[model samples]
Target: MVEQIVEVEAEAVAPIVFWSTENQPERAERTKGIIEGFTAETGIPVELVLVDENNIDSIMAANFAAGTLPDVAFFPLDFAAGWYAEGILDASAASSVVEALDATTFSEGSLALVDTPDGPTAVPSDGWGQFIVYRTDLFEELGLEPPTDFESIRTAAEALEEAGFIGIMSGTDPGQVFTQQTFEHFALANGVSLTDADGNVTLNTPEMVEVLDYYSKLMAEVGPKDTATFWDQSRALYFAGDVGMTVWSPFILDEMAGLRDSVLPSCDECADDPAFIAKNSAFVPAFSGPSGSEAQYGQVSYLGITTGANTEAAQTFVEYWLSDGYLDWLGVAAEGKFPMRRGTTENSTEYIDGWGNLEVGVDRRAPLSDFYSEEVLENIIQGANNIDRWGFTEGQGQLVSAIYSELVIPQAIADIIDGFLTPEDAAVQIQEQVEEIQAALATEE
Candidate 1:
């Protein structure tokens, strides 16, 4: 008998490094657990590095220069496309994972957020839409419709104030990014785009002026007097049932249900039941204004594979994460981490259904469904379908990043509220300033 030589490709055994921007101790621990499960299932080791979100850009830059980038990273949506543009991301690795998982299973909004001509710059993991959580009981008592648009919101705020409740609470801290986020939700509702189809700055348009005027008036007339209220103030006041409505992220869902001890409800009704406010509240995920269609400001996080990564290993890891380990990943912060992948082709709503049942909250645990009605939960899910952002879909993520970094919109809103600048003046100033920034960016290229 003649002996025949047989050869087989060896499986990759190289350990991959995974960087995460979720540096909070507890969040980091949860991520580590997910990584461990991935390792055990595939025999592929991963090193989890917790990095401060603030330092991500600088650290990634240094790693790029040194040619020592990690295999994969869990980063904010803001950096994904920009990094891919800089050639620091391995698009092939992420694309392969998306293909393997079946692209149709993911959220359309999430995928579109990071899309490029080549493919998705990164794989979207999860996200939450900014919410207008309101007093459903109060609206019912006054015979008011849900606040689905600017006119309705304004009417509701005025009526609620007359009924002895603070009308609305929104972030006004000029120096904080929360203020930008809060204002962006209203700006988007008013059909304000940072740039036109040709990438020309259009911040001075009538629609933006109307948005500024409306927002400033609402905050001045019925909002808190301090003019510096942020997320904490708004959330606390709403939980106390002293405010008619407040702008917040879905993370407030678990807290409103009295899931987290540190931020339990304090309303008078809560004396009888901790979830009183939750039972009385309703959420408006997206709203519209006269000049605009309905929309919501969504924030999504992405999993990016680095350029120098062990591509095969990184791809496998990401696929595992979005498949067998996806629910566990979303469970860490279920309220905020809405699943990007809805489910497999065979079970379209599997992940969404699983996500709804995952326990959320710190100190104590309960599924959001326990405190919210099925209709309310479905409302939140539907909101994700309307997620929109300025400049992102227009291939201007870099400019969007610059706008946030400079806090231009927040300052403009602050000036309007402070009486230092008229809405028209703020619009002109914003247009000029953003145009200047856009010009400078153009020169760099």
Candidate 2:
């Protein structure tokens, strides 16, 4: 009877459910380590669910309708804004958490992105910087200038293609969110906002049409045979010496350094040492479009505490997640997780400096500085502040989430590539679809 009573009490206790895209793949091992450590020290029970970014939109939607939202969810700020509008997020709790942790430690850009008249919509955690990476060796050999603008990139890609290698590779697969992300990276460079500040549809504008034309023509002419390559595939192809350039996130840098242990370094010069990729590649933190304005895409990750949950336990989890357990958590993808909150309560630059010093994955654990210079790290830090995202500039976050769920932009780009429509017609259809999604979101509000 005594044992039975203990079992009953334990079963009755609520588990702090959490969700994250980081809970899977190569990062999974490191994630498990941190979560286990958090539970061991704090005695807080957690139930973590892993969701891929590609499918998170649908899964989150279903969870939202069923009221099965996790106690804590790792999501991008724009997506979190939609949940806030639906009353599924607690802005008060988020603000309180940020205050308790001392928000000044965070990067200024991240705070600006999350700040709202009502308070922050999400607790800023970290950021992933995206940019175009190319083979410096090839560019030097061919006497090609760096791909700093749309025209220069085109010129370089064509020249590289003539040399029997594709010019560039990126996320072109519609089934993956990377496709939309890749499209947005280029589109944002051209100043394509999916909607205006008044929630007006703006995807069919002349700028958007030009951007799509550039993307489609580039894919059709210079991309890999599968042009549908997502992040991993694109990264792998570039690493394999199959392509001259790629647009990717910082997460791939360690793997490029030969640290991850999953795939052997495939670049031609990497045969003798896996670190060859780190030695030969060039980084471009931002690029310009025909508009003459340069922009870098930033994905700011956040940890949100949901409504109607174990408040104390959730707050404890958030505190631990941001401070004590932060290094272990970010180290899972340490290369990509540029800390949003710069330091712990202990020291101002402690965490940020530690992040930069974390070793890249080579045959042995070696700091990235061993393979590259301070300029590479500086470029990454600079890119973190030049965030370019749609909907944040306008109040159309709900529409952003809706478009993501519907994959509106990806489908339109696919139509144009498949010979079904011209860029102008495709832009019209995309605008109509986005307008419909906007109307539906407004009705829900």
Candidate 3:
């Protein structure tokens, strides 16, 4: 539980009140280290308030109502546009910081995702793309191709099942956001979008229907019998060599390599070497489907200067965050925190190069490069700039927020898997429900 401070005592010259959602002890320590460096260089003291990611929205709302929103907030992409719409974010301040830092240095894709007619809704800091990680050793023995697309994935899953092994482990818990993210990744590969340019619901399209059918059939055939399986189950099953493939975030890199004691690889080959699975695993950073183009579902965090911010100080801190303090920030969880600001114009790949060498892992520390090859590293870094989501660019961020908050897609998926609805019917159900949500939001306005 987050400690509730009823009031923030003000200094003669107020410290920059920064709200950060990375509440883990290690992550909070790393954040403090960066803030210390910032103060040493710029003499701008910052009070770091660690906010739980799950509680951020409600906390921010309460703060907004009380006129106590922090000077700066490190928050998730899902809230970026919605907060901006609610007049909580100071877009002009965020945009000015981006401009002052040289906008070209940032990942164009990151910037594009939050771009508004006015300017950026927030400064894109860092993010990770979802990955399809498979057992290369098993694939080699079974003569299966990498699971890069729908058909290839299906083929590999079926082959694994026929060989008396579990085919895949992916999120299935309808109540969890991981399920939404997992399904969205597959849907994006199949050219699924929440809406078109004019903000119309597009979930009932043929493409969506095809994706639903493919996903439901594939999961029903080779996935776990229980629908409660989620990220933890998927990762644990993969580490145990019980599943041929698992879709996961890059944060699993260290844990897979046995550097993290709590979740080290426990495969048969790992009896002698915990890194066995890490050595023989292959990753697909981005992939395409028969109906759609190549894409990866990405989640980015942003630094928003709130409407109640100490503007000049907030901008300065943001610039410091994306510049001098950037690598230190990324080093906290290098595997997941891919740099949204790649590097300075002078050294085009400076931060990327530095990030590759930064040490990761908890029980044992080593750079990700020590485990993953240069080619594998490049796939993750390069793919950072090619991410997609449901509706940020379509002026439908509010709708996307509504969809996630209600677990709309996950509900439809659960119904399909339970035989209560066909993929075709699920598509229409999703469309009508989302349309109603969009309409309700419009009415509230």
Candidate 4:
């Protein structure tokens, strides 16, 4: 008989813990599914911890104090860089992972969000680009062409409003993500940027004021009366067939799926059923303003491994998640979630078509559908990268948020929009707040 020596096997280790905000159920589910799939293939177990986004600070603090930080974490873009700066994250190893990933696969703009001093600290999972989703059928009905500039957008809005529909749908309410809707579009239109070379704030220029003035006028005219109440309320109004056109991220395509099932049936039986979004909406690149300027777009979120994580395991996870196959799955699961890598195919077109078909007032047209469109994608990538080149460190993101929130910039903008204060007055108020913030930061430095 062969040597009958009994050998003991090593026990399997537990999978790394990954934490994320439970804000969007679908996103959470998609992430969970992917992780589970990875475990199934690799026999690696993963535990997911869902937390409220607002409570992340307390949770992270507690975890830090206890030396029990998660192996991997999904932090907001605004705070991630700062964490990296404080040595709370292992950026050097993270950079190696980014280097190993297919750099050419990602859009230049999207990759910039994750690029850090030590290296690319994270991989972007989701992001919002400035795009105009308009009613195509309505434009055709009114004999109007798609607008290429800000003035044309205004004209189109006026025409749509005259046809017994709200021209534009935007939520400009204070204490909301109104900046995403207003400042992004306005700044882009006027070619105004938030930061200049050398990482200095440069929003207090004549171009910025002009852009703000344009937004103020737009809010007073075509914007919904209740826009000041909420940012997403406009989405509801748009889906209800009351609004003709709107500017929103591609995620709106996903949200519209549920709305169509729940709301379309009821609307079909109503008197305006046929006329309600008769044609599917189409997305176009945002237009330029009178100054012939175009601003860089914004990045929404990114994914990275925590400094405390097992380096090899974290890299393996990041590689799997950033792979083309996984991105395709994510596109199907989340709809408008575009892939960061260029030349990668995804299931986004199907979702886009479905949402486009449901739109009543717009002709079904596809505009700049390619994620790598040079004119649009390239510029966006450049701007995003430029942010980092200018040294707008993660610390700056926190500083920006603090200044905006504490000084109540939103309220001041609202006042300007309401004509209660002049643009110059608002600018001065904003400048004073910026100076105060600078002084405080100087002391810390």
Instruction: Report the number of the highest-TM-score candidate.
Output: 3
Cand. 3 TM to true fold? 0.97
lDDT of 3 by residue, 392-427 (tens): 978788889899999988888878888899999999
Model 1 C-alpha lDDT per residue in residues 106-127, reported as the tens digit of each score: 8888888788877888998988
Q: What does the lDDT read for residue 187 in candidate 3?
A: 94
Mind giving the per-residue lDDT tens digits that candidate 4 earns over 306-370? 77787788777767666633543344333244445433344323322332222211122123332
lDDT of 1: 0.86
Q: For every model in order, what is the number of clashing pairs?
A: 0, 2, 0, 20
The candidates, ranked best first by lDDT, are 3, 1, 2, 4
Q: What is the TM-score of each candidate against the true structure?
A: 0.95, 0.87, 0.97, 0.79
Residues 188-233, model 2: lDDT tens digits:
8998877776667788888998998999889878875454678877
Q: What TM-score would you give candidate 4 relative to the actual structure? A: 0.79
Error of 2 at 24 (Å): 2.7
Q: What local lDDT score does residue 236 receive in model 2, on the 0 to 100 scale?
A: 82
lDDT of each: 0.86, 0.78, 0.88, 0.57
Number of backbone clashes in candidate 1: 0
Model 2 clashing residue pairs (backbone) = 105-342, 259-361
- Candidate 1: segments with Cα more than 4 A from true spot: 1-13
- Which runs in model 3 stand beyond 4 Å of their true positions? 1-12
